[model samples]
Target: MSGIHLAYDLSFTHTEGRWNQPGAWVGSDFPDVKMFLELARTAERAGVDMLFFGDGSGIPSTWRGSIEPAVEWGIQWPRQDMSPIIAAMSTVTDHIGFGLTYSSTFMHPFYVARLLNSLDHVSGGRIAFNVVASSRGADAANYGYAQLADHDQRYERMEEFIAVCRALWDSVSPDAIERDRATGRFADPAKVHPIDHTGEFFTVKGPLSAVPSPQHHPVVVQAGNSPRGVAASATFADLVFGFGGSLAGQQRHRAMLDAALVDEGRDPAAVGILWATQVIVGRTAAEAITRRDTVLDFWTHEAVGTMLSHNAGYDFSTLPESFRLGELREEIIAANASPAGFIGALVTELGADTVITRDEFFEHGFLAASGLDHTVIGDAATVAETLEQNHADTGARGGFMLSSPLAMPSAYAELSELLVPELRRRGALAPRYPGSTLRENLAV
Candidate 1:
């Protein structure tokens, strides 16, 4: 394994009350490009592998079937298409790779492929595409779907989506661009060929009309923790994004993914899992604990409900006052929603037959929505040691994806400044920026 790889999950930097947190979003508002520009520089200087942004295009409206709570509380709303933001960030920092997410469920593969090719050229091959089969009903509504596609069907689409993208990326041979200035000949007809792709989901013809970027195919990243999802990741993902909430869950995911990789005729050790771990670091453990407490003050019932229901793609507000855990999972799966989220985790912890009250469910949801449950908080050394242990337990293949519930710029500064340096000093991190393109730099 290539030591430990660290990436900052810039996905929700301004969401879930983080903007109002101390040391976060001080001067800039959400979608402020300048904030990202400065952040990119800080992360790159700290030798962070990549900066990631997760996307969901619609407002969160799953709570009681209204958009009010999400809008009022700013629960995972106001997300921008980070493609341009990433392009702008690339210009300011040359080495840091950027992860931009797009949904395979909502978008056409051709548009996404062409757009990523241009961004790859812009960033000098420093772009990673996080292809997702979107799960939220709110997102589906925005895309004009009355309901989400079946869970298994979504993964099916995702595999085909990557297949189409790869074919498109390979359509134009690297030698296709023969710019002979002396002869004024700019042609290589034999090298350029049509993809002529006709699949269950997409249909396209002809070669991609663009020069190949430094890395012909951008690094493909996927985060799918369900059994079907894990199978799909084993098939296409260059890097797997796993939740860091539970070590046992992560271990299971790694083992399942390894077996799936073997079945796919791929090497499991070659793929790494970047666990999405939230953190709050201070000079001292007490200070970090204080910062962690601040998360408790921000969530309310409506806010918690919105956050939980939107992600599950089922309305938690509709849940009865008392229900069995198995019943909830059944309902979620029956609705064509996700069964492997917090509910699945709860099932693993408490037996599936265990009954939970409405209050109890939202109580758990509060900690999750606020990011306090999975957050690792302490002094740099303590936090670093926790990461080391977790990495080793989870196969030590990929590293942690550090996220913060504190403010941006400052919170990220603490991570880049205090935490990463500690890991390097301990010799616990992989070589920093050791390659040219992201595909090489982040390889495990």
Candidate 2:
């Protein structure tokens, strides 16, 4: 395995939610296929191992029971399905893999299995699935649910969802298909067995309609941070998307995931834990910070409140400005599956006992809104040093998932021009993919 494996976390929107900026290409140009193809080509040229898509199925109405801010700022609305884009991009690149997100909360496993399997075959074993449990009520409503499933219940459903998909994927053995002209036989019936699976959430019968695609099963990726989420990742995920707040925080999460793997009777090193981070690089430190500030300036108090309320799944606008967040722990927990782990983080930043009033929460959110979990801003050398140090300190064999605030073209170009070369020089970035499959390349 290379010292650090890099993947690009891509979104179709303006990078980091800065919309309507003059001369910036975002919403109106998102559907342009030419732009996506070039972006994929750029990432492949940078030797990026995979292009991971982060997806949401619904427009936000959780913020003060309103979708105004999300619609106004283009905060993850007007979303498009990424499957076709993945197919198009895969045709243009040989080795760069694609990770597509699908939620277990709404879709049937059989359909998902077929679609992703075909994509994997078409892409020559270069595709992965980022499994998610849908949390928003809007998404659940669209799927015909009155309210979202309870937090743990959602995870329970997901476990069964993955189980059914796995069985279906393995229903047809590798040697099942054979074109024999002499006997006029196409496939060996004995080799293709029925997966008569009957679980609490899903009951799937027989083998899939299509033959087994390349990679047998596309790489299983998960970003479950809650207890149930961790267990699901440990049991089924090939790659686990993780948080990167600090070296200590990263190390703690890694340890928990490793332990979960042990409980599943799997080797700790078998699963790759990838940390998602945002980077701002410039010719100098000051230049980078200036760019970061420009991004941060977009986070007004109202914007912060809207974004926070949306993420936490609770309306902060309903609470008084002087109310202490500590007292509402239970309510927050009840509100969302992964209640703003950010709330806990904000409290930590302000001191443990500090009351997180509405004003304080908005201020902190506004300050840090532009940055991701582990934001790095610096010149190329400084950024490289920080990444290398974090990798060493946290023992992250899985490496980092990078996002550039600049949209696709600028982001990919900057990475190829500035950051990736630095990593290559330090022997951190892999010179080439080890094999045709994403599983082979991401193996640590």
Candidate 3:
């Protein structure tokens, strides 16, 4: 085995009251470049592979048709572009790569390709693009849509989006530029050619008007939980972001992806799935549990509802006193919202025929929204053991994308300073920065 690769998820560093939690930045705040600068240096020192930022452009307004609950509670709201953040982080560190997400459903292929191309240059070939199909109605509304694009249709658009990007990236050959200072000659015109692309969703013309980035094309990362989503990942993703909440689910996802990769005529061994895991590691077991308790006690009913609604793209606040699980799932599906989150799980677990009360639904929603049910909380040794067991239990292909419920620097510090070192001491980690670019290092 080549060993495991790890990345830190900075997607929710300052949100959900994390800024008020212990070990959060005292002087600096969210969007403050200084805190991130320190984090980049720390991450590089620890030999962490990547720092990832998942993005959602719109504020949460799906809960009760208002964004108040999310705004007041800071639930997944107040996010920055992170492109600039990655650029800043790259200047202060080397070796460690950066991953940032963009929506293929909402964004133009040419723009996204050009932007990532430049970012790959800025990061010295360390940039990875996590392309997503937008599902949230709030996100769609921001892009001048009343609701989301149909689920499968979004994936179709994503395919074309990627096709256009690939063509643009390849349009300019890596050796096209000729910087002969003595002759004063420019790029070779023959090497730089136009890509005339017309597809179902997008029509992009041209070779990208920029020098080839360090890697030429940024590493592609995708996270699609559904069968269709998995198929899409097999098509283009260099790395896959998967949910690490359940061992059975993780194993299932791995199996499905392996099959898909084979079907795509790609080597399954070359692709890896970085399980998205929430962690609350500490110096000791007792300390970890105490932090977990803090997490358990953090969410209010409104906050929980807002997060659940925003993510699933369904308003849970409007649920009646009691309803059939199947009916609720069907309603969400009819509305074109995702039928695969909290409600989907309920239907799966308790049977679609089961009747569940609103209170019982929220009871589940609390755990679902806070992500406590899926989180791994323990000291370094215990956490390491759990991870190793999980890695083996699954395929041990990719490692983990660790996110924190506690405040930034504090929770992140525990993973980098404590958990990661433990993993390294146990010889469970892959080589550190073994390759020049993200594609080389992260591609299993």
TM agreement with the true structure for every prediction? 0.98, 0.94, 0.97
**Model 1, span 267-308: residue lDDT tens:** 999999999899999999999989888887778888888888
Candidate that scores best on lDDT = 1
Q: Write the per-residue lDDT of candidate 2 for residues 1-444, one digit (tens) a residue.
A: 437888888764463454443335555467677777988898888798999887877777777787888788766566789899899999999999999999999999999998988999989999899888877766776789887778888888888888888888899987889989999999999989889988888888968877888799889999877667888888888888986576666776788899999999998877777887888888799978776766665676666776666666667788776755565555777765345356656654555456666676666666455555568989999999998888877665688888866555665567777998888988886547889798888873
Residue-wise lDDT of candidate 3 within 136-240, one digit each (tens)?
998898899977878888889998898899889999999999998999998889999989887888877798988889988788899987888989999988899
lDDT (0 to 1) per candidate? 0.89, 0.78, 0.88
Q: Can you rank all candidates by TM-score, best first?
A: 1, 3, 2
Task: Assess candidate 2 and give its lDDT.
Answer: 0.78
Candidate 1's displacement at residue 389, Å, is: 0.8
Model 2 worst lDDT run, 10 consecutive residues: 15-24
Between candidates 1 and 3, the one scoring higher on lDDT is 1
Q: After best superposition, candidate 3 residue 396: deviation in angstroms?
A: 0.9
